[model samples]
Target chain A: MYRQGWLGWLFVAPALLLTCVFFLWPLALVGWMSLHNWPLIGRIRWIGIANYRAMLNDPIFLQSVRFTLTYAAAITPTIFVVAMALALLANGDRRFVGLFRTLWFMPTAIGLSTASVLWVWMLNGQVGIFAAIGRALGLVETDIPYLDSGTNAMIAACSMVVWKTAGFNMVLLLVGLQSIPSELHEAARIDGAGAWQNFRHVTLPLMRRTLKLALFLSITGSLLAFDQFYIITRGGPQNGTISMVYWIYNNAFSSFRTGYAAALSLVLLAVVLLASLAQFMLFRDREDA
Target chain B: MSRNTAAWLYYAACLAVTGVFVFPVLWVLICSLRPAAESALPPAWIPSTLSLENYETLRRVGAGLWRYVGNSVAVSVGSALAVAAVAALAAFGFSRFRFAGRGVAFVLLLAAIMVPFQTVLTPLFIVLRAVGLHNTLLGLGIVYTTFHLPLAIFLMLTAMGAVPRTLDEAAMLDGAGALTVLLRVILPLVAPSLATVVLINFIAGWNEFLAALILMTDQSNYTLPVMLVTVTFGYMGTVDWGALQAATVLTMLPVLALTLCFQRYYVQGLVAGATKG
Candidate 1:
């Protein structure tokens, strides 16, 4: 019996040790550095809550806050709608379903930064395909600056994300849709229900769990968005497209204010955690009640 | 239109979407051959003249290209293998043992899924600095492994649960040790789920951007996402549209090839391993 304990520990030891040393310990260090003034090269001093206070008042940080929330707000709906539509279209019983799935899912597998850079080439104001098409179509006489200002930049960046992520979301939703017993839909149809009615009543209820999971992931992922903004906008024509995480990255990595970045990171963490937790709790309550 | 015609209309609407989605990529493929100057306006959808300059430019910058791809492959494959190994054992523990805090431990692991790495970014960086891991490939690999283990462990447990404890009993009856059962019995039965775990982790690790961006300092160490971003940002003054487009096309080929080749195996495994867990 005693020998079994030794074997168990032996089996699990390697992973435990690695995670402890690498994952847990580093996390603790992050908390410690946030309370002190630690730089990449030299100098370290503990200044309790001063960094935190600065984060609250920093105008740049606030701009990032507004931008991140707004971007998350914009992308979640856009992505989900696109994904659901794709799922429905792909889920049909057709000869070309697999081909369509592959085409749509193609963009999702490409890296977001790669897509952003690719889109940048495609959106170059002077010689981009988009500008040429726009001019030819008589939509505009001149190139409309898509990335010059925050609004158009957000539109541009969010579109890249939608293109990159929508197919993935569709696949997940497709799985959920398939899992819903067809009996539910067949019975609804027996009562002379139309396509829209079947979707509204039977389909929607069955998808609650999947929808919740997808929504939460989309919301949280969008909140932490960084790549497209970093690549496509570089915080934009005037840094208007910069999000919260980008701001943290610039401060910590670019400016070398590691301590201040750590403090700001903690703040961002608290906010995201609270928001996610609230969403999770609401779902749990709704499910039970 | 008749009711039957409406069904055709629905198909037409959705198929039109497929066309819209394919348009940009098709334009890209066509323009890739066009002369750089002639590729611009008058809105030539088809290139009158084709050239290979764009492809040549990518070959010249192969180091910068290959390094990012290498970082991506190494980090992804490494994390998937390591995370799967850890998760397999941990899953066995959770499935077989009736220990205190088992449920709580499971809950905590599930809870970890919702915790975005963003909250821990600064902390994770500081920790990397303390351990002399920052700016290193190995350091970033460690972060990827950490992020994957929770879901991996959960998936492993669900997969391992499909394994019958009777096999362990039978093996034990023959004086086989627990390690022997895991090696000879449990591990083999859970192969499907293991494939799932590996595929899922590999995909997740491949796509990981924020951690790689934050932790790695040097350009030599930059993953594809960082490299792409850096190239785009640096070249903003006088952007090389041809080279950039060629690079994007070149980068996408590998991912497309992998997905197409592994189409059946990947999604099936991912869905099975992920669904219950």
Candidate 2:
């Protein structure tokens, strides 16, 4: 193990080089761009802190942040609840559990944009299957306008996200569940613990790491969501659904305001980092307690 | 309730959940096969007239769906291979060598995992343009590989860690070079992790939207996801539901095939990458 040479560097060079060039360099450039007036097709002007200052008072940007957080807060619980239920149901060695897992996880493979397109057609006002089923079941007299209103659009987008992502969380949680030793459950039973008690004390505590990871991923994914909202609602119903990333996309690509978009991107990065750090610290403190 | 009753209830609940999760895709599949002009109003659970006309129309539609499929395949496969190659090498270095700045470098790489691709979009765009890779599939592949490298490297590090050091030592004692040991001994042992990285990268590259949309401005170079969005929305006035469904189905087919074929590895990769990372 004491033998050392330049071979290690040779092995790591390509990856480190790619990271420096593509990841770190671009990140540093984002920081630099945020301080300037970097338009798409003009001479870049070094206007220090102007983009950040403008964002402070920009109602649309503020709305985008509020909307993105609302969407993330709404969808995270929906996904986790369904995911937990799926994990519990599929935890055991039941026949066809493999099939069930496969079916559940099949949607995660579908791109969000493609899934949005499929759902858009499925939830269409006139010929959508949701409308047809609703009418057939006598749930409504006419087509259900699932994406027409602001609240309805949010609901539609959340449902699509939950469908697309819950499977992924389910798989992760299932791993957590399966990894829990059956001896622990047996010990709980020996202590006269009921099902609720067993789950509350044994299962929840044991799965904390998996739960935290899943929550972090789901929350961050929802915060950075773009494809579904962009495709399904187009931030419609008076632009009520414009997500943070979608707004950044509009500024950077559509409006050609690279500097402002870069500023927004940096703020978002900071928020995500802080949120993740907070979650990590909270979990660590809980473990310590 | 009795034990038998509880078991039955569990089975019923599982079936209900499965149906809820699988029904939308099934509905889309049926819709894709339905004739274009059909009202599809009464909810044709079973199509009266099954036709492949929509798929045919999809093939002949704007931008030619096959081109997007080819572009996606090239980009996804190219990126997955590139990431796997680079990550395997780096993971080997991190897992085995006690090199200088090893911990710092690894930490830096892991930090990139939390940095969303959006943060790097503006600068990356400028760099790609500067390098004259503005609308190239190769450029997009490189970006996908770079963005995916952190997770891939971390996962591969775990994979390589599970491999005992004795194997490397034994290989070196047998006069095998580091590359030979990595390629000959360690790699074959870590095939499962390599497969996991490749599958995950492929799915991610295939599904990546914002980057592809921003980088690949030309229609001819558009990946399937970007093309599907453009084509579906490009016809803003008259939406072709039939063709759109067909296109969506086409877009999902390869990933679905990959998932079904490698279901176990897919689950393992996902869980390890998420919970263990």
Candidate 3:
């Protein structure tokens, strides 16, 4: 055991050291900074709960919290449903399944920022492909500024996310799909279950783990969204699209409010922690039942 | 129902969905070839005057878009190497030994997954500044590696776990060094997973926006995502949508080709990380 201990430490040293130097240390340092009134280029004064309390009272920060949650609520389920649907469609044992999978999965590998850039052009009112196609096909009689309005831009951003991620999620869910034993489906079919019935009774049960993973990831990712909003809309049309993370970003890096940013981060971390714990408990309870 | 009708229905559905999935990316490619003036208002999907003008003009644009591409590659490759190396060593250690705090370490790394990066950016900023690593590739690389280490380690450890410890035991008895056994025997077995991690981490590091955005102030050092943001900046502050799209296509082309080609490894890598299979 003694020899094993040394060896383990030796092996784990690089990871532990790196994590300490990087992740845990930074996390702790940030926590410390949050407790003080930290300016970007001035003496820091300890002011417990002041930064947090200030943001807790700030209307813009409050709006950001609401907006962020609302965005996550909108995007998470939409991505999951679309991903599962794509998974079902792409999982057929056909020779062209790989082709379909790649085609679907390709968008995800494209950087979100890149996608945002491409989308701005694709959705531009005059020269844009969508507008052109819509005009040609008589789908619309007038040019619409797709990213010029908050509601419309938000929808387009969310749609871009769905398009980029559904295939990625499908690919994730595909792993879940593949790991399901085929005979379970065969057995269900023989027991007079139709396709949907088999899916509900057999597939969904086995896919629980993958579904949880996808949901958790999509939710967390959506909540932390920055690149899309930053690149696509700049949280624009009057800051209506400003997300919590983006707000925190504007505080820290843009406005140089180090203390305020740190406090917001800790609060965001707490929210994510609580949410993850709830998810874990919910899944555990389901498993127990 | 007739078999032909059913098959045709499936085909039609697949084609329609594919069209939606593929159209934007394809449109960008077509848009890139158009003359700059025509690019703004050309209604035709195919431009009347085709030119590689944007790709050629991309170099001359004050954004330093091509330099951003180079910076992206440098940071991405560096971070990927660092993450993979640290992750592999830690993963190997975890897989082989039952030791104190092992579970705690593993749990912390796993929990790090749920830690919203935005929350950590402030502290990371301070840390980088203190270490005098701010506004540098090395600083960006360190941040990316640490942020990405959890998943990469999880991927390697899972793959390493599948290689029975008996082989390690046997190799040890035969006088093989731990490093030798790891490099010679274990690494080869997990090549596919390593490749997957490489590709996944490469794409992630390449696209990572927040830290790169915050850390690097110099246009000469901008990553692709940062450069993508720069396309929005102008004298009148109006975003250049056409040039942005053209740049987007140029930046994405390599990653798109890589993922499309090595997609299978991606699936394997994801499953390895997700299920620890």
Indicate which candidate wins on DockQ. Answer: 2
Off by over 4 Å in 3: A1-5, A139-142, A147-149, A179-194, A200-202, B63-66, B98-110, B235-242, B274-277
Tens digit of per-residue lDDT, candidate 2, span A18-127? 99988888999999999999998989999999999999799889999999889888998889999998888888887899888889989988888889988888788677
The RMSD of every model to the true structure, in order and in angstroms, is 3.0, 1.9, 2.4
In angstroms and one decimal each, the interface RMSD of every candidate reads 3.3, 1.9, 2.2
Per-residue C-alpha lDDT of model 1 across residues A1-289, encoded as one tens digit per residue: 2134435555555556666666566556667878888787787999987888888788889889898889988999999999999999889677678888887877766777677787887777776777777888899777868876789998888888888888878888998899888899999999999999999998878888788777877877888888888877879778888888898888887888888888877778787887777776977788842
| Candidate order, DockQ descending | 2, 3, 1
Candidate 2 regions exceeding 4 Å error are A2-4, A190-192, B39-42
Q: Which of the two candidates, 1 or 3, achieves a greater DockQ against the reference?
A: 3
Give a tens-digit lDDT track for model 3, residues B151-211. Answer: 8988887789899887887788888877788898899998877888788888889878788
Which window of 10 residues has the lowest lDDT sum in candidate 3 chain B?
B268-277
| Residue pairs whose backbone atoms clash in candidate 2 | none
Distance (Å) between predicted and true CA of A216, model 2?
Answer: 1.6
Q: Between 2 and 3, whose TM-score is larger? A: 2
CA displacement after TM-score superposition, residue B240 of candidate 2 (Å): 0.8
Q: List fnat, each candidate.
A: 0.47, 0.70, 0.75
Order the candidate numbers by TM-score, best to worst. 2, 3, 1
What fraction of the native alpha-carbon contacts across the interface, defined at 8 angstroms, is recovered by model 1? 0.47
Pick the winner on TM-score between candidates 1 and 2: 2
Clashes of 3: 0
